[model samples]
Target chain A: MEVTASIEKERKTNLWGGGTSPLKASYGKIMMWFFLLSDAFTFSGLLITYGFLRYSYPAFSGPVSAFKPSVDYWPIPEKIFDAVPFLHGVHLPLLFVGIMTFILILSSVTMVLAVEAGQRMDRKDVTKWMLWTIVGGLAFLGCQAWEWSHFITGTEEGMALSNGVIIHGANLQVNEYGPPLFASLFFFITGFHGTHVASGVLLNVIIFYNVVVGTYDKRGHYEMVEKVGLYWHFVDLVWVFVFTFFYLI
Target chain B: MEQVVAVEVKPVDKKKVKKLWKIALILGVVTLIEFVMAFTLPRGYLLYAGFIGLTIVKAFYIVSEFMHLKHEAKALIWSIMLPTIFVIWLIVALLAEGGSILNALY
Candidate 1:
């Protein structure tokens, strides 16, 4: 037993005890993992808070024939987000946001492709993919701006409670939707996520510049591209969760 | 004597491109499925559960393929994933507490 134990100890030491890359991963990348983990906690807090608030309220029932927002219940997601751009009065729920999701995901694909090209030391391919990714990110940002503005300028007429509390469109205090907390959470969560996308765009721009200037080529590897690819993929991942929690649900 | 570098001009990997297109198609199809389900399914826990399940499936594909986490060292993947248990914990705790609060207040 002693001999077997020593051999096992030796093997484990050789694998992990030496001054080497932890799990064969770099410091910065591992740090990125930790950062993503913490960010995940932050998002969890926000989403759980949303769940708590949503649980506190009753959701609307019946078909469109009898639907109306009141203090009695929560507004159904489809009912609230049914407007389409340039087609006023069109009742297409969640369609535009779905398009936004696909765009972000397309950008993620480009990012990974850029990293893959960087792995192959294909400078031109990296540049092309990175540029496409930047465009995707920028397009997503634009769509978000439009969505936010539409949400702010809500189309549905708000119900005025008999207590003389008049709720119009969504402000920080109240909305045409069920409760004030609903719009507040929507703005906070989506705005926080939009900030992430915006920063991601800025990072992509910087990396795109570096790729064009042949910086990674001189360094003999595209670890930076790989790093950014991880972040871009993470942004897509978060959106997947958000889409489900907010839109699809 | 100077060293002469032999630069190999190679084509892009067709297989890699094919793989990327495959992933993109799969994600799109899944989203379409969710869309169909959203409108058709009666509002209840069943619809909610299905949507969350589909979302998780798409998430798995994105993280494993696009992030290349599956190809990374096993230890690395664990380090990143294990912390997610805390998120689950957060969900359970907050949901239960919120429900209790609602019960107590009303």
Candidate 2:
């Protein structure tokens, strides 16, 4: 009877995270998780809608065929993003986007290392990893900046009309690169992700500053790294979907 | 049921970290496979299925090992994953609506 009673007490006590939380995270981290969950739903909704639209439309032709300008058909992603930097007129399909994807994935790795160092409270290691994370974030933003500019400038030098609709050279409505909807969805999705990466960069910079000055050390914990780590990983998670939907599918 | 066995895992050591690296390497290989399938294959359910499957594997590793959610309490882990179901639901609903709209327009 005493053993049963003791077991029941232990169970009750252990019900609400009684066993762990070495970092002593606060309510902010939980709220961030909740926020990320909602944001993820929004992105998934957008991408799946893209999927449905692509499928419901008429299918693509062969590699040599130019995409006819219309809302009734979707563009092929690889053929659209084939332009490589400095190798202008070179048709290396999906190479630039592949590089961008790798950069983001590597940033995610650095963020994980930063989180590990935070757990161990190694100030030097934390600083090093956090700086690498920041650099990766900056590099991604730079790539996005270049991509956006290339998208805006386009390949042609004048307005083009397709089916009686006026579209700027390589604008969202139509493009020298691919179909109209391709440019439209490209800007919307990648723009949103770029905003997230930009914010994440700023956040990491702030945290790096704090770490340099021993802010978390003075507070007796380094949960801030854990919080930002969650955010960084969430951004990476979104990119996984974007990379699949935008570049691959 | 005679509940006589409770497995207590020893605290994580260098060996466990090495094991995690192996798992991560496998996940990376799976991601490369996804890339190949996406690029080489035609647009169809096969490509979509492969992409989503590989994506789930990648997420599993990031959450379990990188985020350290696996070592957390069951309640915490479930709480984290529970929200993803709603995301999936949202995707399904939006996809259906988008499909119907495109169908009508086309």
Candidate 3:
């Protein structure tokens, strides 16, 4: 009884005492932030690896019209990502990717709105916003699937390899784009990000269900929504850099 | 018997909701600018720098406003952001090494 009293006194006196959260956040929220920081490092490592490999190859020079896909140099991104869905055969560079970016940003906005609703303990608004966010995520994923298929199917006139092999689309072995490394990195980086989005959508669904079932209403707080919102925003953050490095640069 | 805790649900803050939409509008406008620049600006370091700058701007908004980091404690913000400096160092070191390798190969 004496020890318990002494510890309680220490907790009251000391900010660093074990009883208090010095960071002004719950344990779960702190852990979530650290997890996101580490995940950011992982993504940075991948993107930096891409930068290293990209710089190792000679950049394609001259006009875009004069550019051709070869193992010789890096391919122009505009030429490679020129195709748009449904508008087939027409050259619309970066249009699809722009749409994808907008969808992600819109979803992020909806997620923040859900978090705001969660703060007010407004279950109805939370449900509505989460559903919209989920739809946005699904739409983005569908767009990615179409893009991957388009890339894998190759163009009508595929590029010829140095060894006289005429390859159509892209694989780990060879791609009709430019350097084989380009396709490899594209698949790995974007695939990893897409997997994150897929899981994010799954998480959103779970959270949405919980919201509908009044789980947070029982828990006395909606901190779970805020945690997931952090993750979803991080995904969008990474995509911003990816879009710049992979496409714009 | 189940223990029931009463949670105080405050009225919705119109200012907060308006701020979120305002940020969203900013993001959309910046993205539109990027798209327009992609076609008009000649591909070079200038364009790349602009894109990177804008991307950083967008990331700042997302992290600060959407993630609520701005409202978080200062210690939490520092702990999360300070480590990312290492990533910048890694980028510089690796890119230099890549440049050297390129020169050696050629």
Candidate 4:
């Protein structure tokens, strides 16, 4: 009776002492959460840096129709990001980015659905949803590539630098946009995000392969899918903020 | 004597699947609203605040429902969220510095 009492006390008091899952989560899952948290910090750092630079610039204040890129002020986002795929010379204004946002959100949904199917140990369902998720990710990446290409290939009438040198498109050194920093930040932030999406698609493919081979079935759990889903959702979450800060604001 | 262990497979829950789609719909509508406001509303502090507020709303749904962070242990949730406070702090501090620099330059 005394030993039983002591065992109960130990269980309550030594929950995190050792050899116990105090958080009621598997070790792998807890580690994944921490990794995500660190990644969140990295992204926040980059975005906050963007905010700082943006604050330092005087915003362009004029009618959109009359707006022109200059070194003196920050260019309006809508005026700059107005092009759409195959709709050359037409001013669409954030339409392509809005579509990219939709694609990322849809991919996030498919990833969560894959996680749900994994909970049920339904391999077929997991495979289907994972494939869809990969496709959505690929689509987003393709859209980003197109957007980058457009930014690199500037408008027909390029902006003249203060030194009187006309630059057509954006490179590391010069751009037709307002401030050269604008193009630099745009490349860094979106390029970083695009890299994440690419890696996420690769991870999804690996997990999908494992699901096909029934590795999880032998292991008797779909926790791997859950881990990768956490990562996939994180990529989507970061894009949500990037969309707001980069495109909307 | 021989013993056999059978893996348990639960039936798919239709309600859960429906809820996931419901969350997706909410996200889609929120993005659409953002796009509408971007063109309709004039650029100013109010517009910026509105955009940020809507963004947080979308983030809550994604993290809580899609990422399943809402159902996790309180300790885990707190651990993740508490560090994000520093990120908020950094934004305020750095933006202030940037504003000062702009004032000095102009």
State which candidate has the highest lDDT. 3
What's the iRMSD of model 1? 2.1
Q: In terms of docking quality, how is candidate 2 classified?
A: incorrect
lDDT of 2 by residue, A15-72 (tens): 5545545333458876777788788777876787677666566666545345444444
Output the TM-score of candidate 1. Answer: 0.92
Model 1 segments beyond 4 Å from truth?
A: A1-13, A63-65, A164-166, B1-10
lDDT of 3 by residue, A26-101 (tens): 8899999999999999999999999898888888888767888888888888889988888989989898999999
Native-to-model Cα distance after best TM-score fit, residue A90 in candidate 1, in Å: 1.0
Q: Measured against the native two-chain assembly using Cα atoms, what DockQ does each of the candidate structures obtain, in the order listed? A: 0.57, 0.19, 0.69, 0.68
Top candidate on TM-score is 4
Off by over 4 Å in 2: A1-25, A61-72, A157-160, A163-168, A172-179, B1-28
lDDT of 3 at A158: 95
Candidates ranked, most accurate by DockQ first: 3, 4, 1, 2
Per-residue lDDT of A73 in model 3: 89
lDDT tens digits by residue: candidate 4, A1-249: 999898878888987776567677888888999999999999999999999998898877787678999978888888899999999999899999999999999999999999999999888889999999999999999999999998999988898876887889897888798788999999999999999999999999999999997888888899999999999999999999999998889
Estimate the overall C-alpha local distance difference test score of candidate 1.
0.85
Q: For each candidate, what TM-score against the reference?
A: 0.92, 0.82, 0.93, 0.96
Deviation from truth (RMSD, Å), model 2: 8.1
Score residue A238 of candidate 3 by CA lDDT: 90
What 10-residue stretch in candidate 3 chain A is worst by lDDT? A14-23
Quote the true-contact fraction of every model.
0.60, 0.28, 0.78, 0.75
